[model samples]
Target: MALFGLFRRKPHERQGFELYGAAVRAARHPLFFARYGVADTLDGRFDLIGLQVALLIRRLHRDPDPRGAALAQAVFDAMFADMDFNLREMGVGDMSIAKRVKNMWEAFHGRARAYEAPLEARDEAALAAALARNVWRGAVAEDAPAPRALAALAMATDDALAGQGLDALLRGQVTFPAPRDMP
Candidate 1:
């Protein structure tokens, strides 16, 4: 019987968070990694994602202009909830890729807001170029659960994004390089 099938209680069936936790458990397989290159490290990626999203949620609650925060939260939620889809989309094979993606997002949010109000023509191309260095893909060795660099980078990104408004960040209108260019 599957591990999930062994659970007699249907707590997860009733609670969305519990269901999500079960999904997280299933995402740990190496076959999962082989099919979806990102999200190889369960704890680190989720922790950083949870932290960042918490901040986004709080910001959305506080912001008078909350559309950006809401959208960012939604995007993050979609990414985290579908571990396989996100990993496959990003072509990530280890934790470092997670970190790189997080850092890139944060850096874009952190420094991309020097443009005109309402973010018209915010020069995303330039901003993306600036953050291009933060991208990482498949840098972890086969034996490693996740790359140390990814953990560090994701933590750093979380710190950066915690204080910011997503709309202001997105309004700044920065473009991210294609995923393949991520280091």
Candidate 2:
């Protein structure tokens, strides 16, 4: 039974991981790191991916379909799994990995909560402040473009996600607007 279970594979899990991968790819878009002034570092990458994942999960949270809830859980699981894998690849010691991952999870959740209200309100200034505080950790350049661009991107991404049908999202067909298209 155990062997069969291992081979059977959970389709939802696979789809969730695929969706997370798509979000990560979107986060890695070069324009953000280059033109938008996001730091080209591990923390910056994680913040971008975390922001994207939060947008998707927020959309799923509002969905009425039960499957949306399941998929949301799956997506969250896949995100943590990816974080664990990333930490391992960075050579974090096994004993410290758990603590590090826990901190990452907390950071992700904190940013998500901070983003929720501004995103829901479509308030660009608030979003910019949140991005500055959380994503940039108050270290953004004095004239950085990222805060404004990222705020616009987050709002645009939220709108895009909202337009996607629950069925389409479940099928791992989510799409985000290009950073260039946001403003």
Candidate 3:
């Protein structure tokens, strides 16, 4: 073996990856597009996954245990790692992939922060406005009810996650409320 391995690194924390997968699957539920009118385009899909991931990360941050912080970091690392791999698979050039991923990270960060205040205050109207702008790119009106429906689902999701124990999440389990069950 050569003195320097090409890319020796610690194995990813499986728990984070599994959790992210759950978030992705939840984001892909058909009702989001069929009923709520979220666009079925790439950007729409990305925003959906980012929203779900943000909610999970929000819940992760609430745990007082030291592991919560570490777990949250792992989730973020896993998400970007997967994004990098996906970009490479899609034939994005090495130079361009970094820039693209950076842009996505920034978008995700901004979207997460935008939801934080409204989510905290249970402001459905504000949450609908943010979702309408981000998920629909402002194509849908804030009072149109589609975004408000998503806001209701989001609120239910936040409540569902809040009810789950930290121990279950640490063990790589998360539960998002079923969209159909939401008003």
Model 3 segments more than 4 A misplaced:
1-12, 181-183
TM-score winner, 1 or 3: 3
Task: Give the Cα RMSD of candidate 3.
Answer: 2.7
lDDT of every model, 2 decimals = 0.38, 0.87, 0.88
Task: Give the per-residue lDDT digits (tens) of candidate 1, residues 119-149.
Answer: 2333334322322322222244422333332
Q: What TM-score would each prediction reach against the true structure?
A: 0.28, 0.91, 0.91
Off by over 4 Å in 2: 1-11, 141-144, 181-183
Instruction: List model 3 lDDT by residue over 106-138, tens digit each.
Output: 999999999999999999999999999999999
| RMSD (CA, Å), each prediction | 15.0, 2.3, 2.7
Q: Which candidate is the best by lDDT?
A: 3
The reply for model 1, stretches above 4 Å from the true place, is: 1-40, 66-69, 81-167, 172-183
Score residue 96 of candidate 3 by CA lDDT: 96
Error at 5, model 2, angstroms: 5.5
Find the 10 residues in a row with the least total lDDT in model 3: 3-12
